[model samples]
Target: MANIQFRLQSSTKEKKPISVRFKVGRKTDVTANTGFSINEKDWTETNLPKKNNDVNKLLHKSLLKLQSFLEDRYNEALTDSTVIDKFWLSNQINECFERVEKKDTGILANHIQFIIDNANTRKVSGRNQIGISKSRVKGYETFKKIIEDYQKTAIKKQIHFLDINKTFVDKFTNWLINTRNYSKNYSGKQLDNLKTVCLDAEKLEIKTNPYIKQIEGFAESNEERFIVTLSFDELEQIRTCNKITNDAHLNARKWILIGCEIGQRASDLLNITKEDIRYKGGRMYLDVIQRKTKKSVTIGIINPYVVDIMKNEFPYKVSTQKLNEHIKKVCEIAEINEKVEGKKLNPEAKKNKPETMRKIQNFYPKWELITTHSFRRSFASNYYKKIPTAVLIQITGHSKESLFLNYINQREDKDANADLFMQFYERLNKDKEPGMTVIRNAQ
Candidate 1:
């Protein structure tokens, strides 16, 4: 049996809260507040509240109730084979009061609320900064709404942390794909977000479901749908197009060109200002600290078209949504209408449909496939052969060489390979080095 008792907390002041301290076998002792305060004079050596008056009687009753609650939890832990340590005891005490008071405790819905409430003002690690982006907070809210919807429609019960097992994960993924019509990648991201919450909960010593750590098959392959990037000729066509009439499309055209030249996300691209530009060593460059990665980069403005936009102070303040909408119009005006294959969510798929690589082979207008992100892809692809990859990664903020290569949809170009081979052959023949004897004999 566990040794459980209530005692007065030490305080320099006249009053202090009472706390429950317990010991199980030979383990280190544990203590937690009972959430009731009393004067030191009212706490006797027996650790019982004095029952001299109505207020004292109420305090005594509350303390007795707390003791009974702890005893019951300790006995329950022994029967269930749960380790009766400080972490377990503390969580038990919290749960007990929450039950008595009819308050939501550490359930999934309440944990999500805690995350949403503190989403902003949460510190960024390795820096003294506070608060995350508003968009990120909105993402948390969206996740909470999805969970709430699932509870209302399917589960018909409150979700607990222990409910996040393999079965729960599979059901949630199916719901997102079939009921919510979320794309595979988007659904995977939502599951990733839930896993992130579970990790945070574990840090708080919450007893999490084991399946949260062991679940598999959440990642989707990128090979099925080809990454679309604008070619140099396509970019030139958009730049030379003279038919843009709307102000928004004209502004979006300039922003797309800027994104293509700078190789940054639309979040960072649309926030550029005159103050961000600097002239160094007889050349102009944009000095930017990326919003997402929080990394600094210096991009030289070598393109004459981009230089003109900076010189004329063209508006770079368009919202990302407007830019995505208007850029397609601009690309359409440029006649970039070639069909490209990509993935789209199937709206007609029924619930419980087994997840498969559902690649539709229908052709989409090139402009239809174009998004604000295409600008960054176009920049990476067009300049990948012209510049060293290391230098390009420094400007594009790609942390890995392989990731950058994949981002540009790097593939074997037969003509490019032939040109490279010919250059190598000429170098070997012209130099006439010792190792070139075999090559010369073959020629």
Candidate 2:
């Protein structure tokens, strides 16, 4: 439901400017002038043009049409969760009236929408669609909300692309970090999105700040990387758990074991089907063309439990989100609750409010940190060195061994390397006297 009204704020004998007030869900109530005027005496009690004359009746019909148009537009905005304010409302009025003076392409919100509108069909390399990912679209919307909140609370005005400069960024960053209590990584993402839209505007031949190119994004330090993986023993605990009776939990447990043995990303692993499994030379293999990197990989299913589950009842497809949730519950039931370093939901944060609970870093129960990503990291750690690094890299779809090694917590086997060197020396000295230069003996 929408509540949009066009009325004069003060009654007078002379014609008064009609103001448009738009409100939805008690969250927004903004006013803007409609650029239509009428004397207060000419209006009916219902705020329509008086029906006493033909001109007034025609004016009433035209106003009704405009009202219907605005209502339809508001419905579309509500469905898309578009950020709305006095400026946005005013723009709608201006657009309906066909006035271009107040319409500025420099506005950040307008430019973002311009990009989004075109993104639906934007193709990359004539094959894949760009900016069509739900995560990316939702991310841009969230970024807009952050900036809107910033302006509302701190600046009390709309910001434009040309307004983006060193000074504006300084205040924006400070307000995001100190005032809003947002993390550097999250705030940096918002800034990065702003830079992206500004660049997009430039490509459209729209004017933008000259310093937009100088704006840089940031990330967390490499040393502070948060890694969460289940060990072999902990994974075994989950495997042996018998308390899970819920079908959803059972389905998630199967995915956890299969994902760990296969060493694939959530997107690729969750897309697994019975048809993807193949039998080659008496060995079971699951084939996948990696979605993110578009790499072809065939992973051997060696774990007996995984092989059994795949053979018996292939997991009914579960969403990535549902799998993450159910797996945590399964692990908790198996008593994998050791306190470890990870991020968890903030206890004090308000529910249903994304801005309230940013992130809290502290030691949480092991099960609390478990996610779909944990299965991949767990596979790498649990079988490191037991399996050839090159083979594992292929299974994981990593481009290089170095990149694969950095993803897991396992250390290099220096002892095994020494043993190999000793064996080499013994073979070289076979059936011959070893030559050694003897120095002074230590006393």
**Which candidate comes out best when scored by TM-score?**
1
List where candidate 2 sits over 4 angstroms from the true fold. Answer: 1-103, 125-131, 348-350, 385-391, 398-406, 409-443
Displacement of the residue 441 alpha carbon in candidate 1, Å? 21
**Local accuracy of candidate 1 as per-residue lDDT tens digits, 44-129:** 88888889889999888877776787887667555544545565666566565654232344567677777778867777656778
Clash totals for all models, in order? Answer: 0, 0
Summarize candidate 2's per-residue lDDT along 284-310 as a digit string, tens digits. 988899876668999877778889999
lDDT of 2 at 420: 61
Model 2, residue 99: C-alpha shift (Å): 9.3
Once model 2 is optimally superposed onto the true structure by TM-score, how far is the C-alpha of residue 25 displaced, in angstroms? 49
The Cα error of candidate 1 at residue 38, in Å, is 31
Q: List lDDT for all candidates, in order.
A: 0.76, 0.78
Q: Candidate 2, TM-score vs. the true structure?
A: 0.66
What are the runs in model 1 whose C-alpha is more than 4 Å off?
1-103, 125-129, 343-361, 411-443
Clashing pairs in 1: none
What number of backbone clashes does candidate 2 have, counting pairs of residues 3 or more apart or in separate chains? 0
